[model samples]
Target: MDRETRLQALSAFLKAKRAKIPPESIGLAPGTRRRTPGLRREEVAQLAGVSTTWYTWLEQGRDIRVSRSVLDSIATALQLNIDERKYLYDLTLESGSGATLWKEESPEISPSLKKIMNELRYCPTIITDRRFFIVGWNEAASCVFLDFEQIPFEQRNMIRLLFARKELRRLAVNWEHFTRGYLAIFRAYYGQYVEDEWYDRFLEEMKRVHPDFDHLWQQSEVKTAPDVLIEFRHAKAGKMMFHLTSLQVQGSADLRCSIYTPDPDSPTENKLKKLMERK
Candidate 1:
């Protein structure tokens, strides 16, 4: 990512993170007539022991040199968790100019990876490129999610599926909750690939087409957690719940292997078996 774009992303991330902290959590009284959500910029500046104007400039995406110590202070002030703190560092800190970023080209899924996914007969598995485009999948994934085979390759993106596909929206029991987390992950990557125009175009198109997507995108929240619980309302199975776990491809950190395992407490396994039988 370029310096300017990285600054802008850092600005947005800090604002989002700042808004999540409650005043009372930091031993500050919740005074009446407070308008902004969570901690104010002045409050963060106070907590981080920096001038409010300088912090304000940071949030405004102005060009300024930021030290590791300052970043550490701000991170502590924001009460950032490990993943969030790493994200903060990634946005602000520069690797050497010789350091390589992930290539924009999609990573090729190896035959072994394909075999691994295909062998999981009961688990729904899919492989997504860095951009969250579906590159490979197993039979169970097609049965659980819609048949990706029928969709055009470019349109088979997870974000597109979530926002554009009514079928997925209908089946997802916790649509907003799921979409927020998914969007947050997407936003996290968006910051890392600031030079990619595809991200810009795709985001604009999504926000234009889907109001819900626009609303969520504007929030600027980010999450890097790989595990999520998803509940789906299947026509034949009634309700099915799955724990979705995402693993990084050993040789390809940018590629993600996501598996949907049936929740032990639910009838999801039996339902999936029955549903797969009809396939």
Candidate 2:
């Protein structure tokens, strides 16, 4: 949708949703002789902890910059569900303002590059685009975590896998901690392509399928590329510790290669070796 139309729809949608919430529902007195059926513009602004003028401007469809935090507050105040909240973001956040963070076409992995990834027998390595779509992975990666080759291409997303896949959750020793960091990085990446179709669809599908994602997403956390120690509980290998490293592919700025190396001093190294031997 064009910017103007998006803004207009945002204004209308907010007003409609706002009207559905009663003052009594939020522990506010329903003042007598109310001209409107629901809360007033000022009430919404007050509840959302934003300025009345700013809320008014938004309701009027003014071309004002909206932050994710502010949108979260407004959505909360309006009692918006996941779908509505997503719609609010899509409408208010104009896509034209941000730089294109993703390529129009997915990058192809050369046979040589694929071979190199596979040759990293000791390190579990996987390649993904900016959007976290798995482009390629080494056998060690499959042995360590999931066999991405078995998953459908459309569902081969790190974020989606983390949120929607039960096996990954079970495998992670620190699932919550790991996901928080992972999501923060994902959110930071998402900011670069808030208006992109792939992002839009990804957000919608995630929110629809994983209820927890919406709550976490609304937190608006952000983090840059991170290096940390991760522990995974493999059914066959037991608990394994790895130092994770994320690096940008040399020529493909949009693509990244993540390698997990077993801690040299820890038993994780021996465990990985045995896992590879078994494979």
- lDDT by residue (176-247, candidate 2, tens digit) is 878877676665555444455565667788899998887766554455566899988999999889898877
Best by TM-score: 1
- Candidate 2 C-alpha error for residue 7, in Å: 8.9
The true-versus-predicted C-alpha distance at residue 215 of model 2, in Å, is 2.1
Q: Alpha carbon lDDT of residue 206, candidate 1?
A: 89
Best by lDDT: 1
- Please list the residue runs of candidate 2 whose C-alpha ends up more than 4 Å from where it truly belongs after superposition: 1-62, 65-106, 250-253
TM-score of each: 0.91, 0.65
Colliding residue pairs in candidate 1: none
Runs with alpha carbons beyond 4 Å of true place in candidate 1: 1-3, 94-106
